[model samples]
Target: MVNKLVFLILSTVILVGNQSFAQKKITLKEAFKDKFLIGVAVNRSQINQSNQEETKLITSQFNALTAENDMKWMYIHPKEDTFNFEQADKLVELAKANDMFVVGHTLVWHSQLAPWVFKTDKGDTINNAELTSRLKKHISTIVEKYKGKIDAWDVVNEALAEDGSYRKSPFYTIGGESFIENAFRFAHTADPEAELYYNDYNLINAEKRDGAIRIINNLKSKNIKIDGVGIQAHWSLEEPTIEEIETAIKMYSETGVKVMFTELDISVLPSPWNSPTADVSVSFENNPTMNPYPNGLPDSVQTQLAKRYAAIFELFNKHADKIGRVTFWGLHDGLSWKNNFPIRGRTDYTLLFDRAMEPKKAFNAVIDTVND
Candidate 1:
């Protein structure tokens, strides 16, 4: 009798353990379902993976993948003389292990770039020739290192402000407008097989839309080797209507460049910035509290956001032939840039998962749309 009781207890424990494991397990096959590409952004800390849990979550959901680190110039080479390839190397290994289509986030960008890149050893502005050589060397070394591992590269990023003009990023001031074209060309030369891209934000607005079209036209006219355009859909709950986003997509597609929703997230909140400090004095230029976060996204708001995503995704599915990949800015809401930018100090939920890592209503809603 005693032996039998012990056996029963052990059986129960095993059963409960199995159930717990099953709850966390999601295969890449399950995540992809019928979609061509569904991706999530990951951080370096997440890659210290002990199990296949995170990998499974990513691969099951996405076919086309991107590293938010390796592609960025600052991440690849933080210091002038030191080029740290550790983080990016791990991402590549993970992608290869999961059979995922990896994309390099960016080769050149105004944001997240090293400040020293604009200056020389003598602390003066580097000449155009030196700048061009550094650009080529950086692109060639990194892209060539990844070679066949990465599928696409966002060679340039966020070069345009909200208006229909250049943001006048450090790269632009140092290398001129031709810098954009040169980045793409240099990246291509590094890995002739990789598809090169230009990424930007606020594309849904009319002014930015025109700017993107003009840039694409400029590249085409110059016979530049541009492949795709990455629309950084850093959207708010209100403002950019579904029609507006679709319109932007159509407009860019008209340029014969494939579009990818690169950095996507909808800020579902009590107010735009979700901060009490944003009462009124927040200036648009420097104040992070300019936009107030909503009180809290109620169930209805969540559903509406899901519907918007579904509609946009439906557009993507319809035009999958012209689309390359759809990537969420961050995998989990806790790590999103929205947590700190635009609003200085605000605790808000604006991603597919909440802080607890559980899929919110929008997650199921998106899945349902994909299934439908």
Candidate 2:
């Protein structure tokens, strides 16, 4: 009887240990496999597979990959006649190897665009014809190169202002609204099979949401192949209420295209403006108060972050049919762009994984939203 009791205790201990181990194996991609594609924007280090730990985390946890900066115009097509395919090729190759869905970050954007694209050799802004030729060539070359490998392309990014008007970017100035229309057309011609999307930030605002819808309507009117709209979800702890997000998702889907939370990262820091903005050009002088959690996020704030992520995921799950994909901007907190955006050199804990690459409370909270 004594031996049997001891055996029973050991069996219970082993069973509980196995259960814990099994629980840990549930990855983000697996948890949301039926909902949407789990994705992360990967940088050069990860694309090159230099950091084995991060690469492993990426392949195991996420099923979709977006090249953070490598595929952007400045990096991919820096000159009128020159095209750089080194890094972009590696990123596509890595994604293919992992059986991951690849996103070509952007084909046209005002920011990070090469000056040569709009200027003549003599330093004058090129004519509309020249600009159109350059835009077509740039989009065609890149899109056709990875036609089938790249699952989607952010055809035009941040082309509208916060108030719902077209941003007077050089693209708009030179080519008018036809610039956006032409971009989608050019990409579609290059790879009719690949999905093309218009990506923007601050889309939760009512006016901006209407602006995105207008773009979708215009594209569909012309029979352009615009597959989705990417709302950059660079949100904060308590702004752009959950209702606003759900409404935006529903509205975008109603336009006959899918919705995507393309670049998601919930910042725990204070906003510099009245509302959340992912305008990379915006910056503020760093102050101690703004960088409140320099040492590390306190437990209270961490709990808040967890709950915030949970609420957001719950909404995503609620409308999973509308959302085609949800991608985090980076893999871990240490690599998050929030650390330098708006205020440079500020330590901000803004990702599901902490600096050590360990899954934080927010990560577990996101998983529980589905599992529970």
Candidate 3:
């Protein structure tokens, strides 16, 4: 019966390999229970509860939900007066049903904005006074409607340039730097209990970090209630070193404001400009060389990704007291913006979960870091 014994042995080995790192009783939310909440961005599909498999993972591993696009200006308020709360309401209800914290993505941003936001009925650019009034009314309507339901909000997003200079966004050009604090003021008026945050990418860069801190300090000086800062931790494998991130964490912590590692994802693809900034407008022509791992991530690159996540989690654990939450940009790599961002049709494996909703090695590495 030598063949029988070999079959038994082979079956045992295969089973063990598959079960070793598969989903278990252990979950990311449970792992980081002692620290901050684990969060993920939910698309409209997730909001409708259509994807049971994805929802199962999200419910088990995450305790915070950020609407991927439902709460944006373009979707929430397509017209100046028309406010649609259909999907937005569903998102909040989903979070409440799951007993998860809810965060409103953004109140003001330059991108994905309606043309009417910057123009009048006559197709003319609105003046500063009219624009400020519009901003106040918009923030008030959304924030007040979900006052107690939404716990936090990205009060203002992407306001600082990478070089620490104020970007010439429409808000800045019309209302000037005063728009930043004014937005915070309007949100506070809507819901004083709601925690407000300013979120942006490239936060690890020293210049941008300083600019953010200056804004936060100025808000506090004006007696405006600014609660936290969201550092969109969209990083790559090699750059920003662990040291740079650690330094930023400490500096933001020093501001006496909670630091959130928002939009946390590590890209495994080649950089288009070798920059750390996250600009959806930036794009390039398709190049297979940029997407070398079209078939899939090699085992070696997977290990590197795992190692990178583990290291970052280790740092987060060290500063768990200062941090508020760590959120993945999306649930799975297949749905990650990186897959279609910068260049369309690129197979980028840049998230903790694979295309099949299976937890990749990086997931385990992060769990291990918090467990330790």
Per TM-score, the best of the predicted structures is 2
TM-score (all chains, Cα) for each model = 0.82, 0.95, 0.93
**Tens digit per residue, CA lDDT, model 3, 149-168:** 99999999999998888889
Considering TM-score, which of the candidate structures 1 and 2 is the better prediction for this target? Answer: 2
Regions of candidate 2 where Cα sits further than 4 Å from its true position? 1-22
Number of clashes recorded per candidate: 17, 0, 0
Candidate 3 pairs with clashing backbones: none
Position 271, candidate 3: lDDT = 83
lDDT of 1 at 104: 84
lDDT of 1 by residue, 1-372 (tens): 999999999998887665521244443235434555777777766554554555556656666667766557777887777787887888888888877778888788766777778787789988888889888888888899989988888888778866779877677777778888888889878888888888887777788779888888998998888888888877766657767877887888889988888877877544434321211223233333543433454677778777766676677766667676778877777777666665455555667777666677667655544431
**Candidate 1 local lDDT, residue 161:** 63
Total clashes in model 2, counting residue pairs 3 or more apart in sequence or in different chains: 0
Instruction: Assess each prediction's global lDDT (C-alpha) against the native.
Output: 0.72, 0.92, 0.90
Give the TM-score (vs. native) of candidate 3: 0.93
Q: Which ranges in model 3 have alpha carbons more than 4 Å from their true place?
A: 1-24
Model 2 agreement with the true structure over 1-372: per-residue lDDT tens digits: 999999999998887665531266589998899999999999999889999999999999999999999889999998878899999899988888889999999999999987788888899989889888988999999999998889999999999999999999999988999999999999999999999999999999999999999999999998988999999999999988999999998899999899999999999999889899988888999999899989999999999999999999999999999999999999999999999999999998889899989988898888878843
The TM-score between candidate 2 and the true structure equals 0.95
